[model samples]
Target: MNTSIFSRFQTRSHGGITLRASAFAAILCAALHAHAAQDIYFNENTSVSSPNRYLNESSNWYTDAGRTQQFEGTLSSDYNGIINTESKISASCASELSLNSLTYNIAAAKDYNNYFASLADNASITLAEDFNVNITFTPETGWNIQTIRMFHNGRITVGGDFNLTFDKNGSGSNGFLEFVIRNDSASAALTNRFQVAGDFNYTAVESGSRLRFVTGIGQFFVGGAMDIGNILWTINNPSSSEGANISLGGLTGTSGMISLGTGMASTMTFTNSAQREAKTTIGYTGDETTLNVTMRASDAKNGYQILRISSGAYGATDANLGDVIIDTGRLDLGMHSGMKGNYLSIAGVDGVFSATASDSGNIGAATFENGEWYAGKIAIDIEGELAYDKIVFNGRFEKTGSDRDMGFEFAFDAYTMRELISAGRGEFILEDVITYETGSSMAGTVFEGNTSGIQWEAVFGDTSLSVSFTVPEPAAVAAVLGAISLAFAALRRGKRA
Candidate 1:
């Protein structure tokens, strides 16, 4: 054969028979042409989302869910699939499947039902576009609350973003992302990951949305800002580096409340500023409905910060960390072994609001280990109020470090300081005597009681460093008291009846 002809002629073995490369290329093209881009619908679809669906079943799929347009091909990145079933437990074999998008679309004109979807073990899905959970309803019926319950024993990778936004003129909807791991060693693999390449923005989702981790080694990552509304994030995984983690790029935007609870040890980290300035309440991740809140050294294991400044995880500094409320839970900020649960890690706490009251002195709201909290480039504020009773603080509230100091302030109702001494605010816990590098100390006759608040200028006489406190009023105590009173009155009325 001539050199030119030989260059075009290559050998390939098919069924033990040699074939020219041109022939192999032609056959490959035909195979590739078989699966074309489509907006495919699962056969389980209905006007009112019902019936279950299978992701791996080919015969159960059709071109139209409402009509009999059977589709005879498997799903691919070139196709867009819809899961119109009320509940979807999709499983893929050992192979990887990538699609344009997946929607848990339960057709709605009636009251909303909680749609469910999860991946079985070893199953994986990659949405090349976005994973959207949407609901449509009439505005006159008010906000029709639609919810989607998410579960994962396997994996789901969203190429774009994941959102549960309202349809039909923004009626209303909420999505509950609960990680129902088997809590067994065989299930929670450290390598299991459920990631969103783009923002996991739930600004569209209404308040009271939840994302709880019962037990799972599946780590979740969000690539963009997490502008979610009010949310209560519960982390109940055991203490381990392999435990589940929810990572976010930034938590800016919404001023909605943020709450956290940790059972064993798990860390929820964010890369940049946590500057939403929302109210954060720390509570237990246990059964809040049936059991009462309890806090002890043993029950509170050593874990990292609830909203651990992931700047340190990525680079460093939650200088823009936001507001927090310790209303219904216990915060374990003690150092166990060499790692101090970064509850309010000094190295990253630009804003550590230690606000409290004296009513519920029963189960001290927050607990801290005996350690120092450094003020990065920003000042630190520890503000609290007082009643007739003492404000409770568990473990030890001691802190003093030679670390970087911007400044520290203890703005408290000093008049009630004497009453709180027995509960443990004996002295301004951050530091009794503000010592400067000049070997000089300042505190005493500044404001009132032991907590007169400290300033960089007052300590080192350096007026450059500024510190301020936005002392949140102690309404939590009154709120608790009112609720208690209401409950007692209701009981009395019932007994009379």
Candidate 2:
């Protein structure tokens, strides 16, 4: 019963004690006044006149527990002004960070390391109109992100370099970092672009990450080593209407691979307007790889050569060129200019050169107008009987080396020695004959005359003879006849005596 008037409140009955209404209203007004002091609101089209507006009002953004801060309410900037901030400015909206026409310029030479760690998946940052802003996203160590999409509508000409570094968290893959340049304006004549005057370096540490450059109408020229898993170009409108091109400028001094298309069936056309050769090497680290080339230019009369072994790596097992099995897999070289003379040449340094056809395939079929077939050693081993349409040796068809007693068998349809006897070009001298059999009869098979001391006979039915005679001239024949008549007269006179 010693409570004071300030501590207790008297009700209408005075038996029950309750807090006074005026005191409760006073406490609520104080709480509301405190919250109103912390809350910052800006009307539509509110402009920031000074460049250091963010640094001037740092207390409004420093309420977060960590170095990262998130703007809680809907904040939009529609004025054409510049915001220079070293700290991170995250304008949160329901769907997009719609900077209507605000140019948010980051401070030069400052590393924004892990400042943009709070960007969510559904949140997209869009820079519209002539809002030329340059921002660098340099991740700190152990920074693993999912994706960060930046869509610029107008022009973003970064005066200095915008360096981006993606550090690998662990063995997992890093997410994509995409920059989209789109012309979101209604006017078709307006062209939006994003240009970097200084060097833009994007360094990736891991192998499973990708960097994509998407554009509706723009051109990207990357200079240095864009070391990512892949540099993807997603040209939305890739036609001539709104053409987009990404020039790599001949990736000099960089040792990496660039994957052109996304999937398996994607076709990438490589065309060279010049007359020089566009040569490409398809190499693999694995054991087996196949290269399929379908040349559809039937109208091209210029011959192209596919040299198989320009150089050789000779091994013990792979000592000869024949060891390399050139599998012409479904090759159809249809009547091209390459099918002319000297179509194929197989040459090697050492060992015998041989060509083989499989049981299922034919080696080739060609017609030679006038060409000599020369072989150092010709060995033909037929599995079955052999037949030739015609065998004509225009030159001397004689074995020139030492004659051995190997014993050979040769069957001919019709043997002729007329040219040898008449033209006196070559002599057919049979050294030895084991057995001789002819299909003709033996009535006058043997020759009865000699011509130029070279006599040849068509002997039939196992007859052998060793006779030599010299062909008499016209004067020699008359002298021989007169001598024979004189001898006959002398014999008759002797008998009468």
Candidate 3:
């Protein structure tokens, strides 16, 4: 054999072969280093203030000035910074946005109220809990809660139907009061409804308590038991679509005052010809969805014009109303007979043609014009293609034609949107957003964002408007990829050497 060939085949006694293997490994690692530099990792806690950094660069996308109504972007923040959970966005006259998912640490004993209250805007807020979450809203006469899972202990006087549900926390031992409308008194005009679900025990908090259930009108003297799993009750009023539908499963504990109708009548009417209108629908069934509406109606001969339609708390006047109205075809209700009263209605609409999947908060194209009023009939469509089993809403309350001269202006006060998506615990997503007064009431010229009837026009002219979103921190993704590459390279080199 040739001397050189023999040398090539000869094993180096000084571990030359091992040295060669090491060099090859080193070269492989160097090549991996070049590739691994591209990997990235995204942190939810990463604070990004600039729109360009979190949006424009790789996440946010927007349209031109002529189309400023359209935009899409993704944001990252601690879970508590956004919504309480996987809740839907609250839509009002003003449009808003929210972060759907977030990451952060949560201790079981921490108060989540601050986090939840912080996100109250005209947008959807969601929080991902890392530990047992406990929240208290405190106790207030209007709206307050001291402890969740427990109803207020005092004589809770509710003018309107009060509904409460405490899942795992409510064990049947507790007691609560329920008030419903009764017609026994000829002067008492029956309006409003009440219902509760679950394997819960309900007691009459008051002896002379006027109560009405799915059955009929009667004074509730003792507590009642409800087991929605096998029994369901629906208090329906043939005169109006206002009633209670209660359904639930499992043991539930509740105690407190259950007041029926708007708690006070001084500012309201409760008699038959008393010009009274109040309704509530509360259900404990994990799946039983209910709709409620309260309107102030007058005798038909008085020229009935709708003043407001709201999901919650239709304020004193219509001039500065803030409610969510669906974007559908023009709201044209030719000619109807009724008196001067505020009306609010809710129904289902076409989900596919109306909204895109994965999208939550929505706006519509209804405009104000002519002496006649047009209002969108709202709906939460669950019929077909847009079959995410999601919720959709369209609300309209208008007064035009001759009734435009009504003195009081519309004022929309409170708005909220809540939904329970998770299967366990009180793992619900709730959006409670409110908009500050615009400093101006519904008045002035028709096209200047107001109509003769103080109608609120679209903030953005074109109704074909929507908000799009994108994922931020593309670098983080690159970091993760690079780390993965480095790990693989290390393993490869270790095996090769």
What is the Cα-based lDDT of residue 253 in candidate 1?
34
Instruction: Report model 3's TM-score to 2 decimal places.
Output: 0.19
User: lDDT of model 2 at residue 367?
Assistant: 15
Candidate 1 per-residue C-alpha lDDT over 290-372 given as tens digits, one digit per residue, 9 for 90 to 100: 10111111112221122211112111111221112221112222111111122333343333323222121211122222223
**Of the candidates numbered 1 and 2, which has the greater TM-score value?**
1
Model 2, C-alpha of 93: deviation from truth (Å): 15
The candidate, 1 or 3, that scores higher on TM-score is 1
lDDT of 1 at 69: 83
Alpha-carbon local distance difference test for all models: 0.41, 0.29, 0.22
Residue range 284-390, candidate 3, lDDT tens digits:
22222222222222222221111112222121111111121222221211111111112222111210012212112222112121111233222112221123121
lDDT of 3 at 433: 13
- Best-performing candidate as measured by TM-score: 1
**Over the stretch 1-497, how does candidate 2's per-residue lDDT look in tens digits?**
66754455554434564557666677778987654423222211112233222321222332232324533444333322244454244332223443334344333212222222122223333433333434433333122222122223333333334455443334243234454444433423124333433344555556654455444434343322222224443434323233334422111111222222211111111111111111111122222222122211112222121212111111111111101111111111111111112111111111111221211121212111111212121111111112211111112122222222111122222223333223334434332121122221221223333333333332322322112222345687778679989999999999999
- Ranking 1 against 2 by lDDT, winner: 1
Better of 1 and 3 by lDDT: 1
Where is model 2 more than 4 Å wrong at Cα? 1-153, 185-190, 221-230, 238-240, 245-497
Clashes of each: 3, 0, 47
* lDDT ranking from best candidate downward: 1, 2, 3
